[model samples]
Target: MLLTIEDLTKTFPGTVALDGVCFDLRAGEVHALLGENGAGKSTLVKCLTGVHARDSGTIWLEGKEISPASTLEAQEAGIGTVYQEVNLLPNLTVAENLTFGRQPTRFGMVSGRKMRAEAEAMLAGYGLDHVNVTRELGTYSVAVQQIVAIARAVALSGKVLILDEPTASLDARETETLFQVVRGLRERGLGIVFISHFLDQVFEISDRLTVLRNGRHITTADTAGMDRLELIHHMLGHELEEAEGRRRHRQGGVERLQVRGLARRGKIEPFDLTVREGEVIGLAGLLGSGRTETADVLFGRTPPDRGDATDADGPIDLRTPRTAIAAGFGYAPEDRKTDGVIADLSVRENIALALQARRGWTKPIPRAEQRRLANDYIRRLDIRTPGAEKAVGDLSGGNQQKVVLARWLAMNPRFLILDEPTRGIDVGAHAEILKLIGELTAQGMSILLISSEFDELIAASDRVIVVRDRRHVSELVGEEIETGRIIDAIAAHENGEGAMTP
Candidate 1:
């Protein structure tokens, strides 16, 4: 083994991020670390790369125990990491970014010529000879920047290269280009750790797999014999049971929203959808599959270039967020921190935002009415707040999410769009959010629920639309929706077979 870990563990306030996690990698093999968000994959990686100190565990490289004290120390120990977003300085030239701190010096003067020469030679080895070393890195396409990042990392003393979501933003050709570079590294006997949410890519590139769930290692298996269904089951930790008492909320009704040719430039391809009242239509796919993009268009967060939406009333143009709000649409975006709440304000103030917007600023919502609205929803949603007067920023993640929901609920929306409502929240909070979905839909609210977790979508949705490459490819409904089929559908898309269901 080139690298081995035994009983690695890490903890943070109110949660254990990693519990007795163990994994290993061999020279010349691509080892994949697989998990959903908050599954301790990041924590374990951080521990190995010295971004966080582990509470307990042992790491061995070449049969010798070694603890990397920092990122610099990790690099010196022959482990180098490249993140999802290329972290190289965009302001600098490709050569400058590549040789940032290690510029050759002659008489204590920096040597630009030496740096560019070294960078050009390194890039040529990775089939990136077309990239001008003297040009600013930001001027290159994302794919070119990614190759530059990999070249720089491998040029350093990197015995083990960690590529985290390296091909996330690349197109098909770009991804193939990256794979060629990776294969070459593998041939050079360098251990590689690849972390990504794409199942097909993992099976295509990895030699072995390690699964993590709820901050603990579930299982590890060689890729040759393992099937995709088994792998998804290991990651999700669930089996499909009869949808009996659990599915009481699906009230059949007429369509409440009809969107035709809705799309934004370079965000999502044009798509059509019909969502009826009391229906939970789940948008299912991996990350960057246009789930959030679809929701953004529906809610007017990202205005559509060419599209028309209609309720039973008439043709409606969602040109902006306020238009969406006025038309009885509610959207709780995926990211709650940057887009959702006014952290500095009181809970009462945050919850009252939407309704006040509807009422207009001149006719400010009465202070007493705002307090009543806040208290009612705080109890209705069971938001854990010190008081309605407490700053929303001071609350836990789950509570902060509730406050965002309350803001929309206050407006009495006819259509609601929720993107990843259960992500990054505690387990207890997850259950509560799921239950609330059932209650809201049972009471005749229409919803478009988007999530990456297949089980959550299967358990709560009336229809699950499988999206791939920013387009809706297939769908599954009651009695037909299972984990295996969903995995197959996703795989089918990758292999160019996913299409409209018969």
Candidate 2:
């Protein structure tokens, strides 16, 4: 092994980010680290790169035990990392950015000519000779900037390279070009760690895989023999066979909203959907699969360039969140703490926010009405707050999530979009939220539920739409909405085949 980690543990104030995690990187191979949210992948990377100090463990480089106190120290110890976003100075020239800190100096002065020559050599070595070294980095495309970032990292540290979602922002052609560069690096005996949410890319580029779940190392296996379904099981911490017994019959409902050709550039691809009254349309996809992007467009957070949306009233313009809210649409975002809840405000104020916004600032709901609305939802949703005047931030995660839902429900919108509604909550809260979904739909409410947990989708969704690479590839209805089927649809190649390949 070129690099090895044993019993690595990292802890925060009240949570353990990594627990007895172990990983190894061999020379001339691409090893992929796989996990969902809070899986300790980021913590492990930070520990290895000296961004976060490990509470306990050992890191061995070239068979020598080493501990790096900083990123510079890690680089000097022969480890390098390139993040999804290019971290280089965009205003500076490529040559200057490459040799910014370690420029070759002459007579106590920085030598510009030597720096450009060195940068040119570095690019040529990495097959990036076409990049103009004298031009400002910001002038180039993101793909080019990403390649430049990779080249700079390799030039700085030649032994072990970590590419964190390097192809995230690139198109198909650009991703292939980046992969070619990575293959060349692996050929030169560099141990490369490739991290990405795109399973297709993982199957194509990685030689081996390490899966982490809930801060513990789950399994390490060769990527060649493992199918996407098996890998998903490891990452999601669930068994597919257990997905049976929850496939219930769907209730055919009336069409509530019709969306045609809705899309936003660089966000979600053009797609058509028909949401039905009393129906739960589940958005199923891996992280970054445009699930949230789809929700954002539907709720007018990211306005679509060209699309027609209509309700029973007639054509509706989804130009902004306010318009969407006015059109009987509501959205509870994925991140509750950041986007959903206003921590400083009391529950009464938070619940009345959307309603007040819709009614306009001048026509504020009377304080009596606000209190009534807040107390009503608090009792109905079974919110565990002591009183409506309690600060929403002080509530538990589950209660906070309920408060967000209560805020939207107070609007009495005909359609609501819930993104990861049960995530980061306790098991009791998870069950309660699922129950609430059923109850809401029973009351003729249309819902778009976005969840990573397949069981939740299977249990609550009348239809499951599988998204991949920002496109809605497959839709399963009735008996077809099973765990394996959803996984197959997600893992299917863009060529429409059920198998994934390079």
Q: Which number leads on lDDT?
A: 2
C-alpha lDDT values of all predictions: 0.80, 0.83
Over 251-367, each residue of candidate 1 has an lDDT whose tens digit, in order, gives 357888888888888888888888888889888876677888888888888899987899899987798889988888889886685788989999999999988988898899999
**What residue pairs are clashing in model 2?**
none
- The ten-residue window of minimal lDDT in model 1 covers 240-249
Task: Give TM per candidate.
Answer: 0.64, 0.61
Error of 1 at 463 (Å): 11
Write one digit per residue (lDDT tens) for candidate 2, span 1-502.
Answer: 8999999999875567799999999999999987764567767888999998989999999999989999888898999999876899999999888887764444137666777887898888666767889999999878889989988889889999998767655656678889999999999999999987667789999999999877899999999989878887787666433333453545667888899888898998888999888889998887778999999998889989878799888999897998899899999886674688899999999999988998899997999999999999887766766688988866645577788988998988889999877654433345556777777888999899998778789988889999999988888888889999998888888885531111
**Candidate 1 Cα outliers beyond 4 Å, as residue runs:** 104-114, 129-136, 139-142, 167-174, 240-317, 330-502
